[model samples]
Target: MAKAIRQIKQVDPAPEEWQAASLSAVVKAAAENGESLIKLLEIIKQLDGMGVLNAMEGLLQNRVDVAEIALGQLNQPTMYHVVKNGMNVFKFLGAIDPEQLQTILSGITSGFEKAAQSGGQESLWKLGKSMRSPEVKRSLAMMTGILAGMGEAMEQNHSLPEGGTDIG
Candidate 1:
């Protein structure tokens, strides 16, 4: 019984592991060329203008339908990564200007709203095609890692006892 319990409690990759894998993928993709890196930066900047953190919050909240709608605009793996990394970078920079941040956040929220209204996947595909930058690819990889980490964390949280108390 003890062994079975331990097995059930075993960690599957863990958030850190997912993050590492994603970051490694990004680094590998980026090492190919400088132009790709520049493209990635541009994509990230666009995502930054789009309010990544709030979207991530929606994702973390288990608002699946809403999150899916918002993520529609990020169907392209590269676009996904750029926005994800942009959010991470912005979060890390505590001194970012408030007004500028608000504007970016508003734009992102509006973009999500618009995507939700448009019932076509073609736009997302086209956006991806437009973001053919190496840097964007790398950022996407890293963002994938961050998302994996978030998933792991969510899973771990779900497996825990309620009220932050020990079950046993």
Candidate 2:
């Protein structure tokens, strides 16, 4: 017990000693992560070149005013609607099947290319023939089905969970 107390008394560090210890630890860490340090320095250099550092410094200088402005903006109805719509869009995206969505996007791209290549207005008979195309009929069916489902969903009454916030 006496030896333990003696060791603790002997090791009581000054402020400068603490600072030196921290610097030594940091130096050791930098040596161990030299590659990571290089990459971090490169990222910092790019940010500085982009004037992001200056922008950050300015933001820090006027942090209180910036925060107040941000808070005021968030309180506005326009901001609220923007946030709500963004959230709903994200929710809708999450609900979609990614593979199916990709296929639909590919189809749209093909349609655009075909339209560009055609480069002219279609005759009345050609327009009527398009209605008989399997792809067109399939797309119309899918679109109508989606619209009907959405209409039904809109008409249905929904209840939120006990702790859930009102989405509206």
Which candidate number would show the highest TM-score if scored against the true structure? 2
Ten residues in a row with the worst lDDT in model 1? 159-168
Q: Residues 19-107, candidate 2, lDDT per residue (tens digit)?
A: 99999999999999999999999999999999999999999999999999999999999999999999999999999999999988998
Which candidate comes out best when scored by lDDT?
2
TM-score of each: 0.21, 0.73
Model 1 spans > 4 angstroms off: 1-126, 159-168
Considering only N, C-alpha and C atoms within 3 Å, which residue pairs clash in candidate 2? none
All-Cα superposition RMSD per candidate: 30.6, 7.8
Model 1: clashing residue pairs?
36-134, 36-135, 37-135, 40-135, 40-136, 50-108, 81-140
- Taking the tens digit of each residue's C-alpha lDDT, what string does model 1 give over 3-119? 443435656898999999999988888787769789989988787789885677766887887778777867978897998999998786766678867865786687578678765
How many residue pairs collide in each prediction?
A: 7, 0
Give the Å error, residue 79, model 2.
1.4
